[model samples]
Target: QVLCGDDRIDAAVTQVISNLSSPFRSGSLLVNKIEAFEGKELKNVADLSAVVVIKSLADTTVRTVRSSRGQSGAEPVAKLVVPALAPTPNYDAALKQLIKVCQEVHVPLISLPGFGDLAQIADEVRFTFLRQLKLNSTRLHTFLMNLVVEEGLEGLVEEVSNQLNRPVSIESAQFSLMASKNMGGTPASQQRSLVDDVHKSVRKQLKVADSNDGKDWIIPTLKVGKRLVAPIMLGENIVGYISSMVRPNDDMEAIAELLRPAALAAMIEFHQNRQTGPMFAATQKSLLRDLLLGGTLAASDQERMEQHYGFDMADGILVFAASALNAQGQPLALDGLPDSFGVMTEIEGTATVVVPYLANSGKTWQQVAEALQKQLKELVKQKPGGADAQIQIGAGRMSETTFDLAESYREARQALIVGSMMHTNKEFTIGYGELGVKRLLYLMIDHPELERFCEEIIEPLESYDEEWESELVPSLRVYLAEGANLNSAARALFIHRHTLRYRLEQIAEILKVDIDSQEVLLNLQIAFQIRDMMSGSTGKRG
Candidate 1:
């Protein structure tokens, strides 16, 4: 049923097959004609990527080509060709016009010889086309597999580009550029680097490829200006993407065919790497703990740590202490932190995270903190009782060396303590700079003298409030927080200024301390801070 040539013998055989077909027995050997075009003649028979049959005559057309571009506009990567027994009107003139157009576009010429009805054998013809497509797909798989074994991903991608005759790029799950094959000595037209573009695209889209559509891993081709992008998927998840400059009037079917093997290669690589991810992460965590504790490491050990964990002693790093409590008010595990960035470890029940500063990212620490907070917020939403989750993050000052990482960790812990008093809001990041006088007071909170002084200064006031369980302590806190501005304190407490004044006088009378003296006020403030620390309310005093 397949038309191999226009020879008489072949034509006779095609007619014979058409006559014997089931549709012929049903009263007609001629069903419907098919016409297909890419926009021009196919440069090679190998350019055929797939074969699709239009079973319903109503669906038949001269050509069906994808109009949209990029990952969002997914189309078959093949030349659409329809076979017919007879030509339409002006067939000769149309063929000539097609040949002229094919010179400038990818449209294949539509030409057919008038003969006996061939539509009755449409099923056989479509089946043969599919068989050919399968054979070609096998060859593509073989080539990609061989290339991967011989030259790895970079060379494999280059070969794919050569085969598809288009540019191809491979990116990691993080959207970082891994390898790319440039087309015809022309650079990608985007002003930004492809890596930057991919990052921006992923951030904006959240996913570069989506499989929720319940089809193949290929994301619909997304066109950015004159470029095309497709995602490489592992099962249902996207592992990376491939992008290229658009070729004018190019049939994307062939390009999509090439990406199938590329995606397979990417999936293989991703799982292979993931197999060792946990072991590698454990080793990295151990090394980080040792480094932060100032444990001596040999030069080889240091080199190994750097090579495997991507930690460089020369680079600046920051430590973050995230103290999380469950709804039960117990310390949560360090596993609560996101795995996207940083090395997190539990130190005495507190989650300590360390991340190297990305000097090239053009982001400040505050910006990084904001991003982490956002990620954590999203993470919490996925957990049970997330609405009740309480997470407080404290960031240390930037450390220039591993030796200073311990210092940063220590400062971060203290910041968490001091931050609780300075900022009452939970589930946020507070840096060491936000710690003022509490910097020194925080370090001394565990001192017996400090605890004793706090007891002496604030115990009477606290005991008095306990007798009535009143708002005296809250009034004092707000009054101090307002820098002695009575109106501000009264407004904040939702009480009249006279009521606040009366409370202050009563507090002074019971404590037998001067309410107006700056010296007494400072002492009382220090005592209250110490008491909070001792009660395990402000931070981990022990």
Candidate 2:
């Protein structure tokens, strides 16, 4: 009978094998290996089987023997390597060599043919081997069977840590903490956030544990550090990761093997949750699209949104559009948005975040927008490529009720377009109230006639870049914006009035129109708007 209290498997197996009956032993003719550790207990047992070697017992010249013991199992209960029958003079040396070979292969106990009538005791020895195998299997299975009923990710991780006698944690693909074991028990000095720079030090100490590797996992153990991080993969995709704290005396290989089943269980649970989660999110997204595009919400629809999205629209709601682009200005895949007070939906390949607003008693909309801006700044900071991604947030005025959400969405979208054209910096948040004359132009820029008329008026001045490229166009825009005030225009352009006059003359000379003509000024205004619309480049001139 085996008494269990987190005892090592090899130690238990060694104790059981040593207690076998004397009939299996060679009495007075003692084997040096078996008698070597007569008083002390065996610390490790590599193989737990009684290997039998016989000359010409099988039909082959030389054979590594396998019994019926390991047929249904992974490891052999006993392995016997038989050599060619040799002369009596060399028999002792041959036996010694066979014994060394058994030790090397980790076969715990070997039975020799010449040792005290081996045929007479064969049946008894086989019975003992079968008993030992059954006992070991039962002990391991009982422990593992208890782990099968672990309910969720926390339970699974806890069981794995218990089995391996170490701390473990599970993190999502983006390195957000999901569940952890023994984290709370750690002394404050050793505990740190997993995403911080300290994690890099932990990763640096890991070395490949198994050189005969498989593609399924990269199992590494600490060579000098204090933790181990392994991937929890779903097919080729690493859906999550598993990590554990390591002690100086810990067996790295054993710890890695222990986490294998936990990782698989975690993956299965993640897959199931993903499969069920999207069905609910899909319904929410569809309703959100309707609410954003149509300026109407029924009583039932309001209740559904509250129940599913948990947003109270009685206070107010703000609509905002957020888009992410890579450093190269191409759209990047955006995920992991804050979904508490808002629902993110795609409109023309851009993401629209619908924020449910609650008024702070007497706060103005500007104050509210500033608060929202701070929250958005924090949200961006949480993203993986937050710094590299060019994020644009365009918000609409706060609509007092759900009925005005469609108008708010349109305003937000226009803000995204017009604000982007008005500013050079890609990262910005603007509201509809802030848009000036560009807002009206924004509504009309889509017309082919507007584009053509602007192109016709400014094409000469725009095309004549080398002659007076920088000075003329800017001078004309400033002069027109300042209402033909020569001093104001000159001050805005940071040029003398005479120089501004010279540039204005150059502009009129190219366009073949008088600068003071009202029709010409209107055309020039439309031309600048067209240029802004066509280029869609931010950082507009004064």
Candidate 3:
């Protein structure tokens, strides 16, 4: 099935391989043919180097020269030459032949590279190529929103740095409209300082050398800081900067290119974070105020807000009132108080106590007052000794409504004011029954004219005749006026029963009336009521 030919066939086969392997060129391969022979026609033709005269029956063009190896006397063999055969084949055999040819030619052949294999060597490199194109298109969208929801900007930076195996420092984080000027102008200087440091560090760490032909390339080293600063550009403007300090095994220019996309993502995220700061602060304030007022939002509502807006609801509440000391050590402005507590707007010139209506741990209004009093007492103790410091506290009333709060505030303030007048330097006071009335009475007692009126009413008794002043007159007045109860009269006057009886005898000697008589008791009772009424009415008019 096979035919042997002249050595010209070997020369033609070699030319075909050379033409296929060489880049595009002219006159590289030429086909040749020879007549079939029954046996080997050319002896020792392997070592012969000479042009063969090829003759062909077909009309293919051929150029030939006389054979130099044969004697001039011998007849030359005719040779036929034609165009070289094409080198097309099946995929499997082609690959095998290509490999074999490469081995024979001492050349290396490689198939197209895959992503998975490249990723194992350098994942950052792979991610960079993938995310850069996609992330650049999304620069207009605020990325900070994602950062805030996932974690804060700082946390995001830390995480990204960790994932990339780099040490990162975020600088000049700001948020505004895309077209806005540098909003952080004053702080830009500080940012520049950090940038400069990063630049110096990076330049020192990166070792670059020039080849003999003056081509620049980098060498690997780990002795110095490798710093990288990336500008986060949104559209035509730069929005922020990300600085990284790292030591990499390879050239960092490639690494910097890889980090650019992630930096852009982080910048977008930081911008969104800045936009929500005020909203977060406002939400926090509202929640704290609500809890202090004892209003409860639904758990679901809270969850929704916290999820959407990232508000925290775990803060504690406190309320306080300010009381300034007067010359006589009495607390002032203690009347006609408002129900709901207001935040202490100012307290530097005077002292204020912020009373929280609602707090954690089920503390009643009374307990709140007690705690405030304790705090105030501590403050007083810290003041200079012998300074005549005076403070009074009233019990707090618990209620959820702001309307009810005023009454409690008023009662507590009034009680404190009254206690200040009654007892000097009292730490705290609670209003109960008669004490509550006394507290109200002292509100009127502040006027000196009222005190004069009260004194005028009692003045007549001080100047009564000697017989009236004698123990008998006072004993009869107290006994008969006090419902003829001997023990009550004796107890009211701080006297023994026998001593009270003796005093009654003396009263009989002076007034000549039986102390037990109903008529006398009625008259005495009327006289005492008249005296009290006169004093009270005069004081009021004064």
Top candidate when judged by TM-score against the true structure:
2
- In terms of lDDT, the poorest run of 10 residues in model 2 is 23-32
Q: Which stretches of candidate 3 lie over 4 Å from their true place?
A: 1-371, 386-390, 432-435, 439-457, 462-494, 498-542
Give the residue spans of candidate 1 off by over 4 A.
1-285, 299-315, 336-340, 359-366, 377-387, 416-428, 433-448, 463-471, 537-542
lDDT of 2 by residue, 1-542 (tens): 11121133233222122332332321111122223333433322233333343321223356666566455776655566766554433244444554555466445334444443444444555567568766765665454444544566777777878877788887654445678887523232322232222224323322232233532234333232476656554433334667788886665655665565556667665655543454335534544555675523457645665667646544777788766655666655554456654666665455677766666556665554555555555555655655576667788888876668788888999888786776534767788888766788887877898878866888777667645446566667779889999999889888889998888888788888898898889878867866776677632442
Give the candidate order by descending lDDT. 1, 2, 3
TM-score, candidate number 2: 0.43
TM-score for all models, in order of appearance: 0.42, 0.43, 0.28
Clash count of each predicted structure: 20, 2, 22
* Higher-scoring candidate on lDDT, 1 or 3: 1
Residue-level error in angstroms, candidate 2, position 375: 3.9
Per-residue lDDT of model 3, residues 1-542, tens digit only = 11122223233111111112224222112111222111222222232222121222222346565565576677776665554533422244434443344344333333322222332323443345347545643652244335535765565565556645666554442312221111122233244343334334333333333233433422221222355556543221233455556565443544464355556666555445433664333333333333333334456534543443222332322333435344465543322122243232211122223344435647755566565555454444544441344446544344343334335445545554455444444444454222533653555565566446434432333344343544544555577647788999899889999999876665544445675677755554544433333343211111
* Candidate scoring better on TM-score of 2 and 3: 2
- Please give, for residues 183-267, the per-residue lDDT of candidate 1 as tens digits: 3221333412433443344333434334345333233445555556665543333446666666766655446556756667655
Least accurate 10 contiguous residues by lDDT in model 1? 8-17
Residue 130, model 3, lDDT: 47
Question: Cα RMSDs of all predictions?
Answer: 21.5, 17.3, 33.2
lDDT of each: 0.59, 0.58, 0.42
